[model samples]
Target: MKTLYETSLKESLAIQKRVIGALLMREIITRYGRNNLGFLWLFVEPLMLTLLIVFLWKFLRADRISSLNIVAFILTGYPMAMMWRNASNRAIGAISANVSLLYHRNVRVLDTIISRTLLEVAGATIAQIAIMAVLIAIRWVDVPNDIFYMLLAWLLMALFAFGLGLIICSIAFKFDAFGKIWSTLSFILLPLSGAFFFVSSLPIQAQKYVLWIPMIHGTEMFRHGYFGSSVITMENPWYLLLCDLVLLFVGLAMVAGFSKGVEAR
Candidate 1:
């Protein structure tokens, strides 16, 4: 016979899964209506952006600037950065966008943010995989040297992105103006994420400072997995993991506090 606590835990898990599933479907429809291509745009949007960047870089003689394979470099770094950026960006207005749904007993603030973050992360992941596969088939990019390491980096970045979304969403909820400008701020900071350049490419002094930013570690780790011994990289996965834990702790606390004050409009 199951204890009351066990029964409650199972019921709660079931409810949360059902709520998240429904929210995921709602987001797909809301963001991309029943029009042409609809949900396909989820990945297609990021894939197009990545391809454009690749084209421009190749056109601009990026290959001349680095010994590394420019296509693989861009493919590895850009999409990982996009996963976190897009996830955090999408999480900004999640609660307000779905406040009506919160009227339901099972739906809560965290669920709303999680749903949006999951959508954005999934889109970025699919886009990254699709592009990598096509490029590999065309012989434009070599197969990764350490696929498991790359997967680990990708998973850590996803968790980092989700934690970041929670914190930023909580902040934006309090200061509405911050929400409006976060996109611009994040764009300006994108280059510092080590997506466009490798840590080894930077000066010795700059590398130390750059490592302080957690996103760069994820990017560097990912590139290390792809490029292998072909390049030098400085990525400490443990540091990124510590940062993730701290962010998740702070972000969840802030959300729990602020969420109580939130009222359906």
Candidate 2:
């Protein structure tokens, strides 16, 4: 029995691996092929944005917000935002976008969403890491204080994204108008995500409010991993983890319920 179970697990993993690679390739071309720079822009995009934000903040504010380096602040914030926003936004339309592919026996709708999210999130992450490396090379930022926390933060961020995506996709599948609503919601959360500022600097009431949102903690945890725990407030990791878990299950339940409607058409 153990051997049979192990064999099935291996086969499933192999299939998932194939799906991951194929989707990554397809996404690279279809998503970036039109641009002259192509995948190189993967590095260029985050670098430019981080530089721009840091420059603007420098000129506008005229001093560092905290002991943290200005460049590092922008660098961390952008990719964390990108991970959450892109993953959830892309996922919101995953089912409808791939509905045509659903006709193909081999293209499972869930795989399509997961693959696309992974490709996008992975590309953005690599680009962010590369930017961090270059900045550190020039002494723009410090080395990652804890590689484990950095990775753990990324995992939590990805899970939070995937979990939220599942819920959004479920809603969008039922109400086509939800696509617009999702975009609107992104704008609302953009400032609240604390991409530029440290969580400690916020008003006490605001910190309490933001703490309830998992992405805030996810971003702070990630920054803490890199800059040391001083960068983010010492919030309860389990609380954020619990929120992530609850939202994840909610997303899964929504997807399960809406999946039948997906097949009816």
Candidate 3:
């Protein structure tokens, strides 16, 4: 009995993995199409946005903020923010758009959200590396001082984004109104994400409140990794991780319940 149960579980896991892969491929083809830049736009879209922001900042604020490298500063923060925002936005109504896929027993609601979030994360990561490589080669920015720490912070941010995306996707599935409301709120939230400024630079009282935002911790920690001892980072990785885990758990439970409810109908 135990052996049979183990075999069944393994088979189920494998099938789910295949379903996710298929969904990923379908998303790429459907969204990007088969020709004329096609999938390359994934990285290019974010790359272009980051470069535009970098240039705008360099032209507007030529003086470095708090002795931080302007190019490196924007590179670290903007791309990550884009990833978080894009992933969450794309996740809204993801299930409704792919309702046909849900007809397949293996293609769960969470899988749809996961596949889209992964695409956004992967594209943003590649675009970040490409941007950094080009800037470093041109002597516009130095390589990160603590690469591992930078990556850790970035990973935490990505996980946080994924959790938030999952939760938003689940909510949007049930309530169409949520999609529009979230779009407006996300724009308002972007400036508060610590992408363009350091948390320590804020007034002491403001800093205390801003630090409550998990993305701020991730962004500050990422900047610290790049600036080394020169920057003051008010980040607690454990706190960010805990928040992300809670969001992820709740998101998954909500998605599962929703999927079951839909299947029943």
The prediction achieving the highest lDDT against the true structure is 1
Residue 164's lDDT in candidate 3:
95
Tens digits of per-residue lDDT, candidate 3, 169-238, equal 8888788899999988988998888998888778998988988898998898899888899788899999
Per-residue CA lDDT of model 2 for 62-86, tens digit only, reads 5654455778877877787877787
Residue pairs with colliding backbones in model 1 are none
Overall lDDT per candidate, in order of appearance = 0.88, 0.76, 0.84
Worst lDDT window (10 residues) for model 3?
62-71
lDDT of 2: 0.76
In model 3, state the lDDT of residue 200: 76
Task: Name the better of 1 and 2 by lDDT.
Answer: 1
Per-residue lDDT of candidate 1, residues 115-134 (tens digit): 99999888888878888898
Error of 3 at 169 (Å): 1.1
Sort the candidates on lDDT, descending order: 1, 3, 2
Q: After superposition, which runs of candidate 1 have C-alpha atoms over 4 Å from their true positions?
A: 37-65
Considering only N, C-alpha and C atoms within 3 Å, which residue pairs clash in candidate 3?
none
